[model samples]
Target: MTNMASYTDPTVKHDALLLFEAVDSNPNGDPDNAGKPRTDLETGHGLVSDASLKRKVRDVVQFQVDEGMLSPADRYQIFIRRGVSLNAQLEDAYGALGQATGKGAKADFVAKSAEYMVARYFDVRMFGAVMSTGNASAGKVTGPVTVGIARSQDPVLPIDMGITRTASTQEEKKDNASQMGNKSVVPFGLYVCRVHYQPTRNNQVSEEDLQVLWTSMANMFELTRSAARPDISVRNLFVFSHSTSLGNAPARKLFDSVTIAKVSDLDLPRTSTDYTVTPPAAKSLPDGVTLTTVV
Candidate 1:
């Protein structure tokens, strides 16, 4: 906290960028590191299984029928829907504690303050700067491509294949995507990288805080791609955190269920890991974790 960086300082911003780089790279730099499984984490990468994919597509179709085909009042109504959440404020002594709801709360500063704090805590963007520049290099040595057959009657072609690890050349990226009626181009990509923390007013990161962060992200990956095809494959998904600003998840068994083994299998960050933050204290964490400060 002594040598803290300010938002306006360009030097601090540059360090911020560097922090992102370090976090994305494996904290141990061990390319062979494939994390174990978490009872709390998803079993496999995406919902790229047989049964679930059909169900998801069916749901989408059903939604179109139910709402898209109906009129405004008959199909759906937007006015009845609620807006953002609000918080309640409590003061010392046996005073009044107001119940605030909706975007615009009462004329209470405490209520607004509480609401803002809650929002910042839950916002994903607060964690780090998200990168849009995905892996565009072609001819990555994808270990194997498996596109599922949609209807079973007409088998889909192999949209993805395991290009040998040593087969990578600076040739054009084989955007050569293809598939039969069965094997539709499924959402597939390499795990470029991800971040663990971002610029924020607070710096104190506790073990439990990191546990919650990973757990939430794990849940999100499942929730987001709940409807992927069986053939689809999620090459990589990871989180990057600054070594100095890393949070310690004392109780979390942060191991992924599945990972693309064989080095050069994918043009990803190389590890199945999204990225890792430099834990605040690694020495004390081997056996158990302890917090030095909390902001």
Candidate 2:
């Protein structure tokens, strides 16, 4: 692939920073804690899991395929999607290869099934999967991309508000007019997530795939609005592309170059403007590394 501002070589190493903000929303709710925002009790910092972020990315890609925006739809199908049976999908792979599990057939069937999955599923190629769960087993593939958990820059306050519904579900209890519920929200927060991409010879990750990934990430929240998360958005997407597949600098070094600090004047950050974001200086980057602002 040629060097460019937005699209870079998919085979090379990549480090990215995603800075997003949430206003009056629960970015990610911890069901374990009564559907409240996940947080570090020791530090009060809000948390958003890597799995949640990837699910958003996967949803965006699935939307694209559903709308016929992505051509050759079979190539971008989602494997870990909702309402889909994993074992059934694995069986399809074996059927496609005309192979049945029998004596001495396990190894060959697993190999071909994994390859078939890599070719058909976009998430498997980018985020990887473990398909060795059921009788129809396809070995796992280490994906090229990995996302880290997102952490808020400052401590967040989760406010649980009591809500009421005017109508009751049961007709027998019509006189029990109002029902009580709870809503969880964060007044405001700024979160940063780190992601890395390293191409391996086993999977097929193309330049077009990378482009779609970036596009989906940038708009991950646009079409995913809900009552619980109506004000979440991507504020910045910084991608550092390395010239060589091995990478010219450690990912930590590249990530540290970009700083996100709260403004001195703000006692509590309530909006994105309360914090200042600084991208890595082009001249300060190591040789053979280029930074691109995809968002």
Candidate 3:
């Protein structure tokens, strides 16, 4: 349902990454209020607005798509939460499934798995964008997006149904609970990474700059493999920037904003049932997908 993710980087371990083009920035949700939308934090701090986050997520998701981790038809879900509560839930509930299944009884199995997945999900630890107000010809007049499900300035980066992660000793069955095995905790996920976005310059971006950013970020995302969608069409693609001033701010380079957050402090993450593997089970695509097998 989107443009395929594109990348030419080569040093990533495909199997190690869990989240495909994910993110994990600071401030959890909105600043002022930690995790809670009500509390107000300082200015020019915290993660970019929800809209900014979505754009970045989409673009990064595109990276995975471009890399062939996922297909154009692959479903991608983006969550803009205030914390990693879901991650805790998965760890607390099903974190030990691997141990019981003989995957090894390490005290830190849960933690390690969580860490790997979070890292994959949040491939980019940083995101920056130029700041400028919307101009009649181009640029965005929109400020930071509110951190809730409201009338977004744009579509949710135009994705298919969201993809939820689940782990299992067996394959996942929707109707029969019997097929579901010790899979309680989601093995991997895709979260947030660094997002450098800002108002568009009249639907414009520098090709050289875009290429460089993609080339670098692609390599970084590759580091976390097992979870990357491996398809460019699935990842979100776009440019982002911030405004240095309000009311028709002029977008400029290096005027990007900064946000930081801890994965443990938030209430996000998902758990899914396990699914056995076979060539057929490897991917799910809509009828419209036209994928090129990765060499």
Candidate 4:
């Protein structure tokens, strides 16, 4: 009894399980630890920050919008792109509406600017933004989507592989003709992430917006390929859509229904086949909830 209808409806609450894998890649680097692969010191489990995953999602949406793959193309503009000025973008809202930015008009200006931002930028509508900086101050918006950090199912081992560059920066250095460096990577790891969507009136998340979010997540790694993470990919995306906006069951319960365990006698998993991933049985779901497999 899994119903696909209303799953993308913004009025209902949704919870998603994102399973992705990395083979010989650095999924996320810790700047605090000299760009090493992020890990938990106590358990040695691989960790990928929610911010890193969101950035990839954003990049995916932006790429699709730029290529005219998504409809209503003007509304899917990305606000947090590199080399773009947030203040400048915020200021444009006032300019577009021809609104004044004086102290007397500050409250209205902020409200209108925030509304304008929500309508124009896809990320602002879905991920929210803090636009209260610089000359134009749009009030802070709480997004409908919340992404949790991704953690490996088992303990991971991150190693640094030594490499050397053929050319040196300085031509005068005759004896030292090459420079050496190390790349941090995990041999293999399967990570699980949770993304929750709770819609509200303020952000105005639509069904089409949810489509963009889901599509972006499914193709996040493919569009964001890099030398350090060429083998990363999305293995599964399990979406749970509630019939009501308040939700029919606790998210944790739904998440628990889907179990993941290592195959018997197989240790040190190197591929997805090494583990057994089980989604919830059709009858196991709570009332007014539907589970949809998107990948």
Clashes of each: 18, 0, 92, 0
Q: Local error of candidate 3 at 254, Å?
A: 11
lDDT for each residue of candidate 2 in 1-295, tens digit (9 for 90 to 100): 2256334577689999999999999999998999999999999999999999999999999999999999789999999988999988987888898887433447866888898999899999999999887777888888999999999988999999999999999999999989999999999999999999998875498888998998899999998899999999999998999987899999999999998887776778899988889997789989998898887
Between which residue pairs do clashes occur in model 4? none
Q: Give me the runs in candidate 1 sitting further than 4 Å from their true place.
A: 1-111, 115-121, 124-184, 202-206, 223-295
Q: Give a tens-digit lDDT track for model 1, residues 25-74.
A: 11111123232110112222211232233233223333433556423322
lDDT tens digits by residue: candidate 3, 235-285:
322222111212122222211221112234333332111111111111342
Better candidate by lDDT, 3 or 4: 4
* Candidate 2: residue 10 Cα off by (Å): 1.8
Clashing pairs in 2: none
What are the TM-scores, per candidate, against the unseen true structure?
Answer: 0.28, 0.96, 0.21, 0.96
Cα lDDT tens digits for candidate 4, 216-243: 9999999877878889999999999998
Off by over 4 Å in 4: 1-4, 101-105
Best by lDDT: 2
Task: Please state the error at residue 225 of candidate 4 in Å.
Answer: 1.5
C-alpha lDDT of all candidate models, in order: 0.25, 0.89, 0.27, 0.89
